[model samples]
Target: MVRGNIRGSAARGGIAACCGLAFLLFGYDQGVLGAVIGLDSFRKEFDDPNRNLEGIIAAIYDIGCFVGAIVAFLTADYFGRKGSITLGTWIMVVGTILQTASFEKIQMIISRIITGIGNGMNTAMLVIQSALIAFGHPLSTFMGLASRQAEPSSFGWRWPIAFQGVFIAAILMFLPFLPESPRWLVHKGRIEEATDVFARLAGKNSTINDPDVVRERDDIVASVEEEKKLGEATWSEVFTEGKNRNISRVLLGAGPYMMNQWSGINCLAYFLPITFERNIHLSVELSLILAGVLGIQYFALSWL
Candidate 1:
């Protein structure tokens, strides 16, 4: 870890900023293609792929994301939170580069999958900052407009895709300087380091043995120990109930997300501009513009 002097709320704020940037990047990537996919230039370049192909192009990223999440689930404990995040950021950088340079439909599909994997590894979003993803929609619509050149230039679409790198860059620049997840540290049996992190989080003058820090550290360690007593869960055990109600708890947590996919917000998020043009019979310019306006409203309202 790149140790720094920041402590208390300042340190916490820095951590929050990094996470916010990541979510913003995630939102931007999700929304950027929504408008771009509807662009005349993009359509022309890709030979106006049928809706079925477009769906695959749009949805394949989530497949990569699923793979990434599973990978993180299996490996995060071994890598630690910071390590996983750092590794994922680098993977995203590669993915973004490939995406921005894509010249073929296949290339774009592969690059997006790679990018999704990276985002999945880092996990998802924070509540209020989750709006950054929505905010990305408008920003992407604006950037997609860069393709309005009289002569067909790919710069508009490429630039927006490339812009994802800026968020990733911001994350990489600051992440190394911040502390790792203290819980992960404790899980790895590094109590002293975890204690130091808790102390640092507590305040500038706090020490590993500070009463409040010790109490917090001990509490976490105790929690970790208690969890270990449950033993490692096998797949069969996970699906069946013994003492943990594992399957029920899993369903409760996953049900909302499953319903969300069913709710068709993703339909709006991924295809709003296209839907407006094709379904509502709006002009292309008006569709893109309205999509952006709606994105702004989504961002604003998410705070509630």
Candidate 2:
């Protein structure tokens, strides 16, 4: 039993590590644009002769972010975390390639929007996955440690984003071995499959059949049977029922969290170089380096 627990812990730790890599990718996607915009090549390619065009070009990525957020909210629950994340990664890969190769201002704008979609999807998916995996686990400890490593300059902005592709590739390589969420399995009425998954996660030896596993399997069956006695609520029913008011309350309360995106810290972070140049009289190159360092510090502190 001790050996089984140890193996189970290790398996959970492996999943946590993979989840942390996903978070790193999330941070990189969010941080890279600021660094790129500060580069001379970006300015020379997009700034043209008009200041208004420059501002418009710069805001296009944020517009993409809005689009991505809406799409993620609408689809992540329906498609599952892994599916959304995989799709988001492909979008990111395409966006990055487009941005890297873009010579025209319009192309850059389009690429930024594409990248924003990926970024938003990644953010939502990562958060949901974290919460789900951490539900019965020691989430704070795992996430706190992972969060410490979220520094922006840990690999510098551009390299971090580029490195995300490698991490995503690594995830794909190992995904076949990963078990789907048991909750999802159970919800789909795959009781036996879900039981097998739970047993595997609990590290049951192939030769040893445990009564505890049977008990757990029976409990799941009983719970599902009980749930069926009370009809499942539709989306509208969930909102209309007083007993389910907590769900609506929580959703309504999340407005403040959404508002944080527009609270100016991110805006400042994204346009740090431009802000420094226009307000503090720093050159673009120096401003980006400073911004990168500061962003790293900000991310590092979040872990603490």
Candidate 3:
């Protein structure tokens, strides 16, 4: 291809699109609850849930996510990126089903843990999680509100929760075709497979032996070799080092997410409509509508 020629394929763009959608799903699931939790039917179904109950329902997912991350870290080498995500996706589907079908708060809490474990596997940069919350929260709120319009029904909140199914379905469809992360391929010593995947990502007419492809693949292998030389790592390294204390880097890496959770931003993301209604004294309908507007803003801001 020419230096500036149009060069992208379904494989190339599809992977990006799938990643975007996956993150979107993550945000949607996280945010959807604020709206659902605020509904009259939901409150009744769960025995008039209070702020404390809301907090529990909202926070339990994080617990599950933490556990999931540990599992992912331990088993990542064996599962590969694609396999890990696929497994997480399946777990999420089960969690979604439970969350959607749940009538009691206990059931919902359990579901949250299961779903969170799945999400934990996929979590990365705090910004990405924030972006997901921003986009999905309001949409979910409105969906719950819409379902409630069919008054005298006890199942309204379930519809909004059920919407997670749609996102999961999309992921299942695209995930299999999405190329594996190059590092995982290289880690497993599948150099040729990694090369082909890299070539495909690069574009048409690119071959496994293409200089750019080969160089990039070698860089990954070299990086892995350097890591091997460093030998097995221990959690202790995160706190100690010879002269270069890794604790500082660890704290720096963790600070954003810690701030996000402790600063009340995440709580707000999952309970915005509730906050608007209960604290700001807005009517339920108006609160959700405004929350939807906030979601739109969050989605727009994510591109930056």
RMSD of 2: 7.9
Model 2 lDDT per residue over 1-304, tens place: 0122333555566556556656555555444555555444445555532556655555776677677778877886566555666677678778877765666878867887897787667666554243322121112122222332434332222342354467567655544455555555565687776676567667636211467666776777777777878876577664563776856786688868778756876666445655776689896556655665555555555554
**Better model by TM-score, 2 or 3?**
3
- Candidate 1 lDDT for residue 32: 81
TM-score of 2: 0.70
Which residue runs of candidate 1 sit more than 4 Å off their true CA positions?
Answer: 124-128, 146-151
Q: Give the per-residue lDDT digits (tens) of candidate 1, residues 34-121.
A: 7788766778878888999998888888888888788788888888878888888898999999988888999999999999999888
- For candidate 2, which ten residues in a row score worst on lDDT? 133-142
How far off is residue 292 in model 2, in Å? 2.4
- How many clashes in candidate 2? 1
Lowest-sum lDDT 10-residue window in model 1: 122-131
Model 2 Cα displacement at 182 (Å)? 1.4
- The C-alpha TM-scores of every prediction are 0.94, 0.70, 0.92
lDDT for each residue of candidate 3 in 209-300, tens digit (9 for 90 to 100): 89999999999999988988999988887788557878888889899978877888886688888789889999888988898888788778
Could you tell me the C-alpha RMSD of candidate 1 in Å? 1.9
